[model samples]
Target: MRLYSEQRFGLVRACVARDGQPLLYAEGYALDPSLTLWGTRSVARLSAKSGRIGFLKLADGQEAMTDLSDPDAINEGAALEIEIAAEARADKLPRARLIGMADGPLRRLSGPLPLIERLKSQARRLIDPQAVFEAAEDPDALDIAEAQAIHPSFDLPGGGYLSIEPTRALIACDIDMGGAGEGMIHTPRQAAKRLNEVAVAEVARRVRLSNLAGLVVVDLIGNKHNGEKLTGLVRDAFLAESPAIACGPITRFGILEFSRPWGARPHGEDTPLKAARRLLWRAVAEARSDAGGRLKLRAPGPVADLVRQCLKDSLDPLTPRLSVETASVTEVVPVR
Candidate 1:
């Protein structure tokens, strides 16, 4: 058995080398004056086999052992050199500067086990040491399912609908109070307040869920004199819910402007507009091929008129099988 003990007197920088080649170096810091690694500490781990670098949390007194001989492929002969440096701290923990080296001939102690079992065993020991030993002798009494469902969703009262319309450049939500407001206090102001509160919460959630980026405008029901109050409420609600999100100030026009990080919109499974455009193009192509002539499409309504005007201005008439579609209130599935 090889015993490996490492204690930091002050700030320590540890370098890990494999096969006489420098693999990685890590620096540990004491955030508090007491020299305790309670808060976040920087840790860097680099791959010897691959040149990839990884950063992680370095908690004090955390030890891990692995065998190099097994299929796990841990190279135990890998040398580790630790360099200690002294720092002035008000707490006066200790001051020592020394270099340390360690080597181990790793050996496997047990076969591979399921992650759940390993975690359960580790947690049991940490939480209740006496119970862990007793429970080890009698394993049949433990209810695994109780531990599995640790965090479950609490059901919401309202059946809310969230509509993300990119064309409109706005997210409109229609929420039905849904039986929860049956016997409670009911007034336009009160109702608006409650709905606004719920909507604000939902907005933050949807922003995260949808990962929507760019200028977002929310068209919420206007509250009379409480407009400014409502805006403040929504702004405060979002700030509390998601501190990381950079939301801008709400304008007097009830437009809330903010930007999410750039990427593909989440849950962006084929929109109806895209589907309609695809179908329209396919149909126009088929029509042109059948007639062996150029196809002309007329503007149908206000939305279609806008699309036609746009097409005429933006596209060339000589372009083959040109297709166009417009936005509408009705939901239609385009057929090929």
Candidate 2:
């Protein structure tokens, strides 16, 4: 397994690729990582959402998560040692989350453990440190733009294209064979089937790439007779990528709904998830390359907060080489 990490524009973005396939995309929100568990011990704020118990950490909105469906609720702002849990494929609170409390004590979780730690634990295997990329110098390393474009809708490989829209209700995906483009067929059914085939793979990747969880409605073009036959194809496609997703029966209308948590919007304004990862990496590299005991990071509050929180693990090997310093610290060294 190889890891590619980058930091730029105050946000950090990281991707994990194995066997030449990108399996994971992790971003930072400083407060709202699509899935971020900050410090093992955090103050919890309780609430109710969709009849389920919701927990929020006032200090970091990114850590806002829900508790299991139980009558017991923790007092708001009560500090507790939180345990991390991961849901393999379902989207309603799918992905890694705080399942309960850890047995040990802590000084506020030492600030969210490095994402690499979580990534490593999930894989149950060590990452290739030699291949651990900080940027483009590594041959297999994909630039952040290419990494960000891993979404099928944005990275359509042929004449066929897809339009994905996320709403409060569900995510809607529409496939357009883009008619005159490459790999398109003359027969309408064949073209629709071919397009749907391509869409199956693309949709599967998109769902995982976007961290799209919750209810997802995919609209493919095909004859009603083909819907049943194609259902297995669609289901298989998603299963290859994530078992957490389950597709509902297809309607004559050619609509299929998938259940997963709603991920970050694909086409809207890009959130800071990627940028957070980038800054985190850049700071680490700069820290390791620096001569002083202090590594200076100069990002705004959110960006700096993410770097300070997520780079904990990577900082260890280089600790004696360099230490962490916020932009505000100006006596010894300064970085912008």
Whose lDDT is greatest here? 2
Residues 1-336 of candidate 1 have per-residue lDDT tens digits of 011111122222222222222112222221122212111112211123222211111123322221122323333234322211222222222121112223442221133333223333322322222222111211111112111111111223353333444433544443444443555555655654565566655554444333334455565544343555545655553443244345665556655555433222222333332233333344444554555444444333553453343345444332344444454442222223
Please list the C-alpha lDDT of all candidates, in the order they appear: 0.33, 0.51
Q: Report model 2's TM-score to 2 decimal places.
A: 0.58
Residue 66, candidate 1: alpha-carbon lDDT: 15
Model 2 Cα lDDT, one tens digit per residue, 1-65: 66665443333456666656665555443233322342233434443333455555433454445
Backbone clashes, candidate 2: 28
**Which stretches of candidate 1 lie above 4 Å from their native place?**
1-156, 159-162, 168-186, 225-253, 270-336
Per-model TM against the reference? 0.28, 0.58
Question: Where does candidate 2 stray beyond 4 Å?
Answer: 6-12, 18-21, 27-112, 121-141, 144-152, 180-186, 237-243, 262-336
Query: Tell me, what's the RMSD of every candidate?
Result: 24.6, 8.4
